[model samples]
Target: MRVTFGRHKHPRFETYTLHNGIDIDAPLDAPVNAVHDGTVAFADQFLGYGLMVILDHGGKNHTLYAHLAEARVQPGQHVSAGDVLGTVGASSVEGPGVYFELRSQGKPQDPLEWLAREGH
Candidate 1:
């Protein structure tokens, strides 16, 4: 998995702003899966995110998947971890990749810290 961009203050044009998510570079149409079991909160085109899916895992924890070519889930749908949510698309501000974010109580958190490491 190639992580093109990480959660940080990225320089854009003349100013720098916090990038609340991480961008994982992938081939077009690559499967995008849910990181955890959750109910789909939203599934549609949203601003610069292009086609996106937001999953509410309860307890104020949520995960977002952006830059999708198409969404396979619908709002209010329950999805389990590893379920395919969509396919990677070239709709991101960077390029062809899936932009993922984890939020707790509406605040973005580093996904790397929450994701399981290989072999663990």
Candidate 2:
């Protein structure tokens, strides 16, 4: 996990609340993969999120991929762990990298804990 969830000061906001996910540095257009088996729930441009993809891992668990250069999967498409979902990119609001999050019931969880448990 590169950037963790926490308070941050922003030039415009004065004080930014928290990061919803971890940021992983990657080259522009580098492939982004799924961490678990799931179906693509969303794939489109989201406000402030840039190009993004959201995968539903069942049990209300989900993974979000942001700042993507391109989305490879579509809604309802089944994907397995390690399957490529998109390529990393940077928008005006962010830099070249992938913003990742693991959520259960819509609540963000520590990705390192989850990755470690999964033997990543």
Candidate 3:
């Protein structure tokens, strides 16, 4: 849940951007897991996101997983925290890393603030 930049060269800033990005070290084709309970609302190829997954956590809250090498879930899927949703990818415009976003009521929000201490 902690927002650690997937690539140190590209630090996802908060002052200019509302989203938080990070890298998952599961390796090439490593399994990706959901950080919390949510329903898959979008599962498709996004612009700079490449293969992406969006989960609606309900109550006007959502989580987005992008730049994946492989996606294992589908739209409308109900996933729990720690559920395997996809695999790590190496073809993101942001480089070989996972791009994460937390949205509130369809608007962008900071993922670092929502993550509990000792976040994964």
Candidate 4:
């Protein structure tokens, strides 16, 4: 997994503060998968996120996959880890890659930490 951008504060943007997620570089149309078992909470265009999919993993844990060329899942759909949620698309502010975010209790968490913990 090539991470183009990571979770951190950006001093360059006047209004933008922190980047709550990581941007993984992938070829256009590459399949993007669910990080864990969850139910699709949302699957549609979301502001600058473009075509995105938000997964609800219960316990207020959620995972968001943005910049998708196509969404394979739908709202309320159950998905296991590694299930195809969508395909990578050039819809991000950073270019052609997937913007991934992990949240707990509605707060952003470091996805790299979680991925490392999962041995990814």
TM-score of each: 0.86, 0.89, 0.76, 0.88
Model 1 alpha-carbon miss at residue 38, Å = 0.3
Better of 2 and 3 by lDDT: 2
Q: Which parts of model 2 have CA positions greater than 4 angstroms off?
A: 8-16, 92-94
Better of 2 and 3 by TM-score: 2
lDDT of all the models against the reference?
Answer: 0.86, 0.88, 0.76, 0.88
Put down candidate 2 lDDT per residue, 1-120, tens digits, no spaces. 457765567779687778778888888999999999999999999998899999999999999999899999999999999999999889625468888888999898888788989998
Clashing pairs in 2: none
Model 1, 8-110: lDDT tens digits are 4334655555678878888999999988899999999999889999999999999999999999999999999899999999997667999888899999887
Using lDDT as the measure, name the better of candidate 1 and candidate 3.
Answer: 1
**Residue 78 of model 3, lDDT score:** 96
Worst 10 residues of 2 by lDDT: 1-10
lDDT of 2 at 1: 42
- By lDDT rank, best first, the candidates go 4, 2, 1, 3
The Cα RMSD of model 3 versus the native structure comes to 4.6
Per-residue accuracy of model 4 over 8-112 as CA lDDT, tens digit each: 444576443467888888899999999899999999998989999999999999999999999999999999999999999998766789999999999988898
Worst 10 residues of 3 by lDDT: 1-10
lDDT of 3 at 44: 94
Show model 1 residue runs off by greater than 4 Å. Answer: 1-14, 117-120
Best by TM-score: 2
